[model samples]
Target: MDSFDGFVTGLREQLDGPLPGTSAQLTMAPSYRMTPEQARVEGKSCREAGVLALLFPDGSRVHVVLTVRRDELPDHPGQIAFPGGQREAGESLRATALREAHEEVGLQRDRVQVLGALTPLYIPPSNFCVHPFVGVTAAPPALCPTDAEVAHILRVPLDHLLRPEARRREPWTLHGSTVDVPFFAVDDHTVWGATAMMLAELLAVVRPLYPSLTIPS
Candidate 1:
């Protein structure tokens, strides 16, 4: 487990350094990706939100926990996303991330060792400014999704995303505009938009440490 410890150590260190930020996020971003100026010009009031990218280890490989929203959810229905939602009044973004993870996926906050946060992103479609936090659970979590919001729970091996074939693009029409969308294909789910953007930074931070990990293909 030297590699597992290394992954955790590397994550904590990278979070303290200058992040890849929007440049890396934009690599996987769609053409419709909103800019801060546009958000201001639209005069849209956005709710503050937070999400957790929680990692775990199974044997020598590291995995991240994600959730697919139920098709009936009012916002971003049927989309694969990190477990999160708008923060309550007086709640810290970090607390929001931990709390949402617990409520949606039954991940006990006490079990999570939060590393640090990634760059905050604004989602035009949802009108939310999402703060993404990186965290880890020493043992595999007993994750159970709330039937009201979650449709599936995905435990994706992090190394799977490091491969050349992990990223792909497709044409899609959004709000009457056609754009080429880059997304990561996990299982049968298409992870794109703000969720993919957040993952982009997470991957950028984790990518450098892959050479030291002893994961099997």
Candidate 2:
């Protein structure tokens, strides 16, 4: 098997054990990160949402898909995010992730092999308890976004993320407070907040496979 397949195999095995959990997720969190108790109390009535980190091979390298939301959206507008949204009444979170991906980006649900889930994170601003899942599609998806929700698609190579330079920090004001924000420096976007936290956990899980790279500490 090729390196990508071997990496997937190892990732499946690792997801079976205990996750890196909050420690890994918090690595990319803003300076105003919340405590567990705060997440619980505030998240009591928070809406549940599902997000996916969809991986696939592009040429010989593995790439993950992220979406740039339309600037006019009610919630986190003009932000980089995974292709997912709130859960339906009877749908499982995994199903929600797949369904939302299909609706937003035309991802064929059946073609994706879900490796496992990462730790759930609560977003204070949106009041969403976001559940993250890692899945792999056999091939690159033929993206057909309707432009109603998604403004653009970013297919980022795993190698780019594993490099230390992709992680950067700066001061940003949120809710009238200035806080040091850690974000993934993608092409022109600042990937921070819930999306950055989820990506941090994913990198923590997959970092072992790219040991030669100087990943951010």
* lDDT leader: 2
The Cα local distance difference test for each model comes to 0.85, 0.86
> Which stretch of 10 consecutive residues in model 1 shows the poorest summed lDDT?
34-43
Candidates' TM-scores? 0.91, 0.93
Q: Check candidate 1 and list the clashing pairs.
A: none
lDDT of 1 by residue, 120-181 (tens): 88776667888899999997899999648898999999888766577889999987889989
lDDT of 1 at 177: 82
List candidate 1 stretches off by more than 4 Å: 34-45, 212-217
Q: Any idea what lDDT model 1 has?
A: 0.85
Report the C-alpha lDDT of model 2 over 13-88, residue by residue, as the tens digit: 8788888888787888888784555333243678999989999988888899999998999977899999999999
Error of 2 at 140 (Å): 1.3
